[model samples]
Target: MDIHDHNRRAWDRAAAAGERWSAPVSPEVIAAARRGDWAIRLTPDRDVPREWFGDLAGARVLGLASGGGQQCPVLAAAGARVVSFDASEGQLARDREVAEREGLELELVRGDMADLGVFEDGGFDLVWHPVSNVFAPDVLPVWRECQRVLRPGGRLLAGFMSPAYYLFDFERAMATGECVAIHPAPYSDLHSLDAAAREKLVAAGELLEYGHSLEDQIGGQLRAGFRLEAFFDDHWSGGPEALDALMPTSHATLARKPEAAT
Candidate 1:
């Protein structure tokens, strides 16, 4: 089966069920954004620093694989020309629902993150991607696509799962038992995990995920024509505080596409 298609349907169902990531932002949040007092998250808990977004007025922003009605509406309200692209129809529908209710004008496109063919090269001033590339099997292609879509000197603010997040046995960790390392870094249910674990995910209709190394997560951007500017590690607050204190589970990066030779 095609991984992207399978994941797309899974996210569609997830959005229908009102999964946390699928929930739309409130009108009050939109109002706050319009007043220039808004923040968005690439990870749970902490808001992305506002300075990363220098100015939003008339900026062309692309929400890369970041849909479900949350960030896009705020960007629109903040005076950006926003385009929200996602792989799931249902997620895009949630963004559309918000746009209608909030009276925001933003375009919604559904496609693979690795191939942003619908967008012209150098068309976007910023590519705002949250922690979604874990759903893609190969991340380099996605980074390359982000570089291609962004105008020279444009910024890409992205969040992703840290490779270490997948090392622990999830069930054991959830049970408050000792968190044992059952898998290595660069994990994947489709290829790296045992057949039983893979079958479990398949049966549950859960989205398949890949654990990308820092090399691919960070180095990939460098290779894709992006210059790393800022980075931060973040913990998953929903989990046990001890686990969060032990180490960060996710990270966000700010990168810039180099301007054309003078």
Candidate 2:
């Protein structure tokens, strides 16, 4: 399966349906951000610490898979030269909508997160990635590409589902409020789900998610030459899953590319 193409269509449908993550931000949010009262999330509820961004004034930021018109517009309002990149046209359109609505400058690009070939090496000071990468089948390439696009000392602020979140039968847990361990880490909807279930998902236009292991999600950043800086755990806000109430199902990380050797 062409996961990129499939997920793009699914996300486009989700955007059209006004899914939570696909919805655009309000003008008030943009206005506030312009006044330097801006906050963006790498996870569900916890705002990414402002210090993680240093000073946004004139920072070159790539909103990698962050094209829901949420973070990119805020970053632009906060004085960053922002590029909103994603695979889904519907998702990118949300950012474009807000950009037009607020007269904010944002470069919108549609592309896979794992292959950031459109961007030049060391082009961005920060890559703001949220939880969308769960749609990608592999995450190591995503980390490597993020590392490749960031300049020395550039930061990567990312959020992802913990591998543990994939171990459960989420559908069952949501329906019965019981955490039933069924799958392993590094799970794939394509391979993990039964044929009938996969067909139902495809028919419903839902996202095909992947559960990457910590080795690929976090350790991959270290393997790609980024020095881990800060980490935090977060939970889904008002989530339906049983585990959402028991423990954190998501995580955020701050990493920085090493300074250039003299």
Candidate 3:
């Protein structure tokens, strides 16, 4: 890898303390998160629709590097047997308390997402990959594992940043073709938060890994055996229309694993 890629990788691995990047979970995000949070702000309700219980009902889910029971609390409430894992002890502790208070049961584990040596193969039906897939150096390795752990026809629902979001990063660039790579977004990860906070994380050694293109995002899923089901161009979570056209920045796609091998 070149020096830029090497520097980016180092910076990315160092962003574990992603302070505020993963928003604190609450009731609204669980019931109809597509309509609730920052994720769906730029799109329509039907654009990125989902229900924790309806879609994940009876589905054994392994939230990949899931922090603070963010999606765990709701899925568990909805009757899905869910396992939450993360490398952060403090985050898991907070999740444990929430699980207990909510009368929900969540199996919380602390470890890395790259190595799930503790769990058996084909042990889960779903791997929730919201905003976390970019953490790995090469996402395919992780996607391959997600495929291994899933039963045939299982789904991997992942959310990532759209390319158009760069417009926000380069909001001022339109004025001058000078296109300053204003932010140090990691090569393939998405740092979706206010600019100031994003820079703060970067300064603390956090680098963003933005796939930067919808085609690349979908290609990863297809190569890993997931069939593209649907896609949304979300400007923000449950908000006004996203009229920015520079990079077509929106939540790009929704995909599922095919039941039959191609």
Cα lDDT tens digits for candidate 3, 25-87: 665555453333323221222233564213555679887665554556656766678898766
What global local distance difference test value does model 1 have? 0.91
- What tens digits encode model 2's per-residue C-alpha lDDT throughout 1-262? 7889988998898889888888899999999999889888998889999999988899999999987878899999999999999999999999999999999999999999999999999999999999988999889999999999999999999999888888888878878999988986678898888899989988887789998889988889999999999999999866755788888989999999999999
lDDT of 1 by residue, 1-262 (tens): 6899989999999999998999999989999988988899998777999989878899999998998989999899999999999999999999999999989998999999999999899999999999999999999999999999999999999999889888888777778756678887788878777889889898888999999999999999999989999999888988755557778999999999999999
Pairs with steric clashes in candidate 2: none
| Residue 51 lDDT in candidate 2 | 95
Error of 1 at 5 (Å): 0.8
Error of 2 at 32 (Å): 0.6
* Stretches of candidate 1 exceeding 4 Å from the true structure: 240-242
Can you give the TM-score per candidate against the true fold?
0.97, 0.97, 0.65
The true-versus-predicted C-alpha distance at residue 191 of model 1, in Å, is 2.4
Compared with the true structure, the alpha-carbon lDDT of candidate 3 equals 0.57
Residue 241 displacement (Å), model 2: 4.6
